[model samples]
Target: MKFSTAAIMAFPAALLLAWQAAAAPGQGPDAETRAWWTITEALSNDRMEGRDTGSAGYDRAAQLVADKFKAAGLKPLGDKGSWFQPVAMNEIAIERAGIGVGDRPLVFLQDITVDPSNAMPVTVDAPLAYRGYCGAAALGDVRGKIVICHGVNRPGLPGAAERIAAVKAAGGIGLATIADPGFAIEPPRWPFAYARSVTLANASPDTDGFLRLRLKADALKKAIGDHGPDAGDLIAKGSAGEPLPGFDIRESFHATFTVKRRQITSSNVIGLLPGSDPASTDQAIVLSAHLDGYGFGTPVNGDGLYNGTLDDAAYVALLIRVAEQRRGKGYRRPVIFAAFTGEEKGLLGSTWFVAHPTLPRTSIAANINLDQLRPIFPLDLLTVHALDDTSLGDDVRAVANGMNIAVQHDPEPARNLLRRSDQWPFLQAGIPATAFVFGYRPGTESERIYRQWYRTGYHTPLDDPHQHIDWKAAADFNRFFKTLVERVADQEAAPAWKAGSSLRPAGH
Candidate 1:
């Protein structure tokens, strides 16, 4: 049951509708879920080619969204009064690379991965230093070495930025952070399709000759063979965030890289549904989801396309469903629908949009972002990011409660998921915002399914339409999203930040 772009594009309208309706009896999606699945299937089918930013496939998906918006009676609210806002970006990818420690060669994207940067050297042979956690105090005399640090994400542990700065301050040439295996809430994923980076076109690229690398946890021992402290003990202590002594490894590091760079132009799809009331019409409530994915990448289990069905294609479809349900009606406040690009490239699309909004920036009242919302299992509980930072949390909690769904604040804040999506950009701009994840108690079947998805499907070729889905859960969340939107849009006052929240920006 695979579909290709050419075959789908060649089908007549009636034939296509018939094909869509030919699902097996009793196995078909529920009526409530059918429309949502239809849109998702269209966007995520093989023809779209994973919808990578600035690619032809992304353009096709964007056009489909724009057509849907027009049919739903939404007005163009993008740049130059069109349904598209062009975003210029610079894309960099590692065309080829190899790394080794002493005589042991490490497999690229398997044993280790290098973060692509223009500043990375084509070849390097430097001494290695093991600085536990790479904390400032532990980074002593790492000058000209490739520093190794434990990648711990919990509080009190020096995070990536802190470790990188400390290494640079100690005159280190590169840093390799071992992927922590102890973080069970969200474990590190391996075999990245490729190493790439996309940044705003006008932004300055990293010019310093400092390399960033992520070594697979299991590879740490092999990388340090008989050179320093017992690798097993170091991993155990580092995973626990326990202090360990820093030492220079006797092994030297060597690597060569072939990098490619290109200029790309991706667009954000924007549409507006005006408000019924004149007074509140100026203040818009934004609904957003990223439309970019990894596109074609290194093959996994013989599949190369990263369809991104649940990662975000499904939610983008959910947005279209919302617009269709409105059917030309306006809420009390204007609603802006934003289908963003370059989210996988570090939230570049949303960041650009926030900096250069089509409408006045001050007119944005709030943002209800849709990303990382996996309803693969039952929709019994939801983990809400920024749940306590703004009144938007209250709105969502009330809505979920009325629907018999439990809502909890992000239980694993150390994942920093709160700042990983489009919502964070809105939050940074002083607009109330939040996102969600389907929650499960530890040791539940739902938890297993969630973790399995993260391990096999997340950012992989397995994230396609063929994957198992809880249709009932999907419908339940769709209803919840629509209800929450109406409740916030029709409310008299705009959502506000809660007092004493650290996330709150100055001046309201």
Candidate 2:
């Protein structure tokens, strides 16, 4: 269904006016912030159904953004000169699964979660081994065994990929990683809405048949009852990144799985704001935010919709606001506004965009991605990812310092957050990029608010518009973003990879 510009603007315009009227003379969000919220509310309201990738809800949201882009006087830069680049995807989910140790069964999604795969075996009854961190040295001759390892998300510790490779090479059929309890910055959240994975439709499924699973720290005792080292002691050692004993469980592990698979199509909404200066028109600055959310999921407090207000709806709205603000006059460098899909699934959309950009890949100057940002507290500081990798960091620091906002490199690198968002794909492609998080000092009220939001609102229904917001913080970040973009887009030199940066491609 197509919507006229008038029809599309009608609802949001009314919402903006209502929000403005309700604002106390001087007590609420500023006018610009109110406008930003109006767009956010329109995209994140229950009516949009959380904008799940490839769903009608997402399509509706995409069309709305395209309409806004058209009204903003931006030129469509998607496939076939339209405002969207269609991306084909394959989604897989676990319908039901059971995992057990001896006669004890672990709860699905509560005690354990498995990665869904088309190549998953129907049943496996194999000897179990506790291989500590599953490092190559600890993994003994475990032919046809399921290995359990401590899941540590920090540098210098064996991570998931390395552990999986070691186990697979050692002929292990499965791996269960015990969730780390010591990572206080971002502790694990349980009862995940569901276990789902999405990949580009053209990508081949893994045929290796190795099972991947995550075990709750509290459930470790039950899973290894009377078979291996004491669960409590092992967890303590692993959490502290200490060496641990590797031993075989006396009892065999059993598992059965049922998976559902389907193919779907989603799109990235793209628009081009042509540079006013013809000399710099070929160099485009890409501004991006993901539009996909969890959609409906296992109910938390009887509300299943993951509205994703700040997880990204708010940032997408911010992109639209930027387009609207510069409708008639674009920056010196062309700006590509991309509302990407399938970020929640795994950065699929941006990956696709980088591989198949609407414009020449060489012309993309830099990307300033907006995700993983929360304005629940004052924006006293900003944590910039890739802060040392490229000149973009210098641009951010200059703009932020003017606003009295301290800029710092990622404080929590163990989270592996730098590789977790849309900006990652661009960086991998040798395009200088950066993303941000509102920073806080340790043990402060600001830190408490930031942590609390991740605990309750990060990916849950609690991320809706009704949640408390720091109006000043929201407005301040918006201003900072606007200024940063102008500075980067108007600057004479294109962003460059810093010397000695590992991410810089040859000749870049």
Candidate 3:
């Protein structure tokens, strides 16, 4: 979802001209481009209804991809000889929540936004300890206290989840985080009508239950009395990325949360192209992309549907194109094409797939996940997630180099993108995995366009097929991705984690 721009300008003038020439509409694209467009356009069409996870729209989209897999002669690798691996999910919608300090009641979403994570019901009344930013230095005496943290977390430091994990480890009863308005990627501090959590009905809670919320500055200021550094000052300082100190707020906070739950199931479309070589046939190269989008959300530009055309549907189309192009042919290792559901919902589908694989867990050799390939600009560079963690990174570089596209490491690690996508589960399971985003160097038109897409179209109705797409760039990327798959599948050795990789499993 980010880029680097100066590397783009380094391309030769003739290369730019050729790229422009290839993008012209009347020139007509070849079969791969046409196929990719046809599938992407169809998936993003109104008929698909944004393909929200666990919705009928998503079911229809899954069937559509399954039909394509069938047509391409890919064998079903899903449940009960069908083309879908069903995943059970529990949807939790917050009904109501409240917070209070002394006589002042903090209004929901306006005065604060609470975390909807429901391991068990949450109710807490505890003394507040103002733990500045949740940094190590600020966490000294938070045991059994309600810790107040400024901002989600410091940049280049632990994220909200990680900080909360530390808090739980420190025996904190609850946490309240102040949001920073300065970060462009931060979502608005609006009330969430509902939230989702994995339905691990049989498992015990991972940690002791706690109250977590993001408090508005005004509300916190009122709650803390006429305190040192009013809420506004604290928020402003946090916004400017300044360090804060811990102190006892000398107030008791009360919170209560409630949620309703319903069980739902989503399906991941799984198909496999069998390997020809006996030695490698048992191993599988998994190609993945999410098949779900926002579905319906707060309306954007007068439209409610978040048709994820380039955010994914396009990459799913690329998967189908690979199936088509590889028809009547075979790789050395089996190639598994998986269009996962619930990527927009905490990578649920892929997580389920890894936990309950259609094939043996040991058979998965590697994962190459695709998502949000913005071809609005030229495809001069590619960003490979986890670029330094596995040999799959080397494979990606070789493929990109062969296609004359520069390969770049992720430019925005703060996004935590490597752990955000479907590839993450595979990596966590000790499989070498990677995901890609189109790259642009800093200070280029490519960077501007890329930023513009995220700001305006990302998760919005503007992401529909009607949006402009550099078809030639799409074609180029599809080709490069297809070759990358081929190279991985044909390689003599299965993909491997690099030594000293933090993601590497013990003794791997």
Candidate with best TM-score: 1
TM-score of each: 0.92, 0.91, 0.81
After aligning candidate 1 to the native by TM-score, how far in Å is the CA of 135 from where it should be?
A: 2.3
lDDT string for model 2 (1-508, tens) is 4444355335332242233235313346889999999999999999889999999999999999999999998999999999999999998888788888999899888899888776878688999888898998889899899899999876787888899999999999999999888776787777677888788998887786898888999999888896567899999998998988988888888988777789999999999999988888778999999999989887776788988899899999999999999965888899999999999998999999999999999999999999998877789899999898999999998999899999988888878899999999999999999999999999886886576566567888878887777788899999999999999999899788899997787777
Q: Across residues 1-508, which tens digit of lDDT does each residue of candidate 1 receive?
A: 8566457546543344345336312355687699899899899999999999999999999999999999999999999999999999998898888889999989999889988887788898999988889999888898899999999987888998999999999899999999998886777877778899889998987787789999998888878988678999999898988888888878899999888999999999999999999999767999999998889988876788999988799999999999998998999999999999999999999999999999999899999999998767789999998889988899998999999999998888788899999999999988999889999998886786677567666898878887777777888899999999999999998888999999888987
TM-score of 3: 0.81
The local lDDT score (0 to 100) that residue 115 gets in candidate 1 is: 87
Residues 463-487, candidate 3, lDDT per residue (tens digit)?
Answer: 7876766767877888788888988
Top candidate when judged by lDDT against the true structure? 1
Runs off by more than 4 Å, candidate 1: 1-28, 242-245
Whole-model lDDT, candidate 2? Answer: 0.87
Clashing pairs in 2: none
Candidate 3: where are CA atoms >4 Å away?
1-31, 96-112, 119-131, 136-147, 152-162, 165-172, 184-194, 200-207, 215-233, 245-258, 491-493
Give candidate 2's TM-score: 0.91
lDDT of each: 0.88, 0.87, 0.77
